[model samples]
Structure formats: C-alpha cells, structure tokens
Target: MKIAVASGKGGAGKTSIAASLVLAKRGVLAMDLDVEEPNLGILLGCSPGELRPVHQPVAYVEPDLCSGCGRCAQACAYGAIAWFGSGLPVVNESLCHGCGVCPLVCPTGAMREREKVIGEIRSGFVDGAPFLEGRLEVGGVSTVRLIEATIQAGESLHADDWIMDAPPGASCPVSAVLREADAAILVVEPTPFGLSDVAGVLEVVADMKKPAGIVANKTGMGDLSLDDLCRRFSVEVFARYPFTRSAAKAGARGVCPYRSEETWVWKTESLWRAIERRFS
Candidate 1:
C-alpha cells in the first residue's frame, strides 16, 4: 500500500510518524518528499552517501541556432521562456517544467531539451526497511520536478509498503506527493491552528477522493477540540500522541520516540495497525 503522511503546517511531527511506521513495518519503502527541508534521514540516522542525485530535463536555448522569434516563449505555459526584445529567448532554468513543448515550437531549433541536476535522490536501509528521499537545492523553485523524481525513485524499488512523507501545507508540493497515495494520514496538533489547517488538507483530499484519517499529536496539552472538527467533517481520528517532555527531547536528538515502548509509541504502533487494517 502507498501511504502518505502529511500535516497542515510544520513542526507537527509528520516525519516522526512516517519514520516510525517505516521501522515498525517490514519491507516498507520510506520516501521523504519534503525536498525543501528533508529531515527524515537525520531522524533515522541514515547517512548522506547512501543518497544519490536525481536529475530532470530542462530547456536549454542554443543562441546560435537562429532567429529570435518568440514562438518558443509563447508556447511555454509556465513562463519559463522569456523573450528579450531582439535577442534569442532566454530560458529561466528554475521556472521551466521541461515539458518539451518549447523545443517543438522553436522554428529555428534554438531551444533544446537537456538534463539538469536540480536535486538528489537518496536511499538507505534503516532496520531493514528501505528509506528513499529527495532534496532540492536551496533557492530552487522546481519542487514539483524534484518530487516527481523522488516518486520515480521509490516506485522503481517495488517494495511491499510505500510510506511517503510529504512537506507541510496543502500546496503544489504536497499535492504532487499525495497524488498517487493509496491512503493519506493527516497529522495535526489539538490546537485551533492545527484544526484549521487540517480542514484545508481534508478538502483537497476529499476533492481527490482519497481515503484519509487523522492523527492528533500532542493531545494532552490542548483543548482536544479537534475531535469535534473531525466528527463534523466525517473524518476518523485514528490516533493520538500525548504531550511529553522526554518525547520532545528524544525528537531534538534526532530519534524516533516510537523506539521506546512508551505511551505515544504504543499509540503510534496501534495507529499503524489501524491504517493497515483499513487499507491493506
């Protein structure tokens, strides 16, 4: 089963949940699609060398090829191609989606498709579970392309279970990662802000018609009103993690709190079993 773990905002323990699931379930391939700020490798104690670079094709304008017509620029829907008054069109490497249409529209063959190393895809073994992740270069805006690369890397493995950990927020990056997931686990805190953001995520999932569930993290410290919100939205509250200082410290040390047989860990284990039962 392909499961995606996501959150409405950052610092909601999404990666922690995803990593614990990978460790608990055997033969699982963990993919970290949070390319912007991937911390899954750090939390799992996986080394950087195990990961490799993943590249994507972007347009390269060959100035010598000819007439500075704006057909290439007009054909590009992503605004990746910009035409300077009379010069050959300049390709904005960052904005290009490498859709290959620009080259087709170039009358003079001035635009060519070339592979660019925009990001890296890394994979390592964590407690016998295969962990794969992608990282986009800083200041890079082609997160969607890198995410596609990450998905391709994980799909090539053909593991029994594919656990995808998406970046925070319900935007293009999150949508790209969650597109093909069999199930989605939306992790949220019990606070008001968490409830509001999760509602947005649920709307997106609902529109996609993807099955989903909620995991309330840091449950004991807040009002726990998220339960009402879930019920109102007809979403299941699959699990809860109580607020604990030791758990916090372990996370700060880049460790999975689920490593111990404690309250939150046991709860997370049960949550995984529930997810498997619902989607397996």
Candidate 2:
C-alpha cells in the first residue's frame, strides 16, 4: 500500500508526520518527493545517499550541418529556439524544457540534445527502510519532471508499503507525487489559514478521487472547526498531535520529536496502524 502525506502549505508538520510513520515501522520504504527541499533523510537521522544526477535534454546546434530551415524553431513549443530567417537557430537554455522536439524536427540533423544535470535523486537507508529523495538545482523550475523521475526510481524497487513525502500545495509537483498514491494524508494545522491550505489540496485529491484522510497537527493552538469541514467533505480526520515544547525544540534542531522521545514514538506507531486499518 503506497501512501502519500501532503499539505496545502508548508510548515504544517507534513514532513514530521511522514517521518514518524516511516520510522514507526521497520522496512517501510520512505520516499521524499519534495524535490525543491527534501529534508526527510535529515529528519530520519541519515547521511546523504547515493546520488545520481537527473539529466535533461538541452538543445545544441551543429553550425556546420545547419540548413537554417527554421523547422527546429517552429517545433519547439517552449520557444527555446529562435531563428531570424538566416543561420542556425539560437537556443535559449533557460527557456528550454528539454522536450527533444527540436532535434526530431531538424531535417539536417543539426539539432541534438546534450544531457544537462538539472537535479539529482539520492538513495539511502533510514533504519531498515529504503529512503529516496530528489533535489532540484538551485533556481531550477523543473520540479514536476524531477518528482516523476524520483518516484519512477522508487517504483523500480517494488516496495509494497511505501510512504511518499510530497511537496506542499496543490501544484504540479504535488499532483505528480500523489498520482500513484493509494491513499493520501492531508496534514493541516487547526487554524483558518490551515483550512484554506487544506481546501486547495483537497480539491486536487477529490478531483483525482483518491481515498484521503486529514491530520490536525499542532492541536489546541487554534479553533478552526476542522471537524465540521471534514464532515462536510465526508472525509475523516484520523490523527491529531498536540502542541508540545519538546516537539518544537527537536524540530528547531532538525530532529523529529518521535525519534528523540519514546512517547511520541508510540503515538506515531498507533497512528500508522489506524491509517492501515482504514486504507490498507
């Protein structure tokens, strides 16, 4: 059973809950799909893993073999290529999405793809569970593709119980990670702002028609009436974590509260079992 834990906004304890569940059990594969900022490994007390660059095709022009037919420029949907009715087309690397269409439309075979490392996928272990995380290049905007590639690598291992730590919000990257999820856990704080964030993610999950549950993290901090909201949507709020000083302190130091204390550890164990009972 593949489960994804996500939120509509960042800092909603999404990663904390995801890390807890993955560590609560032995050999449960944990994948961090937040390519822009993956901290699951750090929270799980592990070093950087085996790294493989996520390569993308970048268009390069072969001036000698160029016919300046402008076919390559016309085929580029991203407008990465520009031709002025003479000479080889100029390629804008920053605008390129690496679709490889320019090369396919090149009649003289003048356009070809050069592999560029835009990001990397790392594989390591957190306890006995396999850990995979994707990191995008600084200033790189190609998160969806990197998330897709990272998940594909994880799927190749054929793990039965996988927990995906997805990016926040209902954007393309989050959708990419949740596409293959068997179940989704939308973690949110008990606040009006938190509900707004949850609403955004709920829309996407609902449209996908995936079985989903809610988690009210940092409970007692606010009275957001999450129960009524869940009831209206006919979704269950399965877990709630009370705000605690220890959790705050541990999080400040890049540590998970469940890993640092036994009480939180047990709480996480029970929470995962509840999730399995309902979704598995």
Which candidate leads the pack in TM-score? 1
Q: Which stretches of candidate 2 lie over 4 Å from their true place?
A: 64-75, 82-89, 105-108, 261-263
Q: Against the true structure, whose lDDT is highest?
A: 2
Cα lDDT tens digits, model 1, 62-84, are: 87895887888888999988887
TM-score of 1: 0.90
Worst 10 residues of 1 by lDDT: 260-269
**Model 2: per-residue Cα lDDT over 1-280, one tens digit each:** 9899999999999999999998788888899998899999889887765999998878899999999899988888888899998887999886788987888888888898897888999998887668999999998777888998998999898888998999999998999988989889999999888998889899898889898999888987875778677876778888788888889789889998887877677778778877988897
For model 2, give the 10-residue run with minimal summed lDDT.
223-232
Count clashing residue pairs per candidate.
1, 0
lDDT of each: 0.84, 0.88
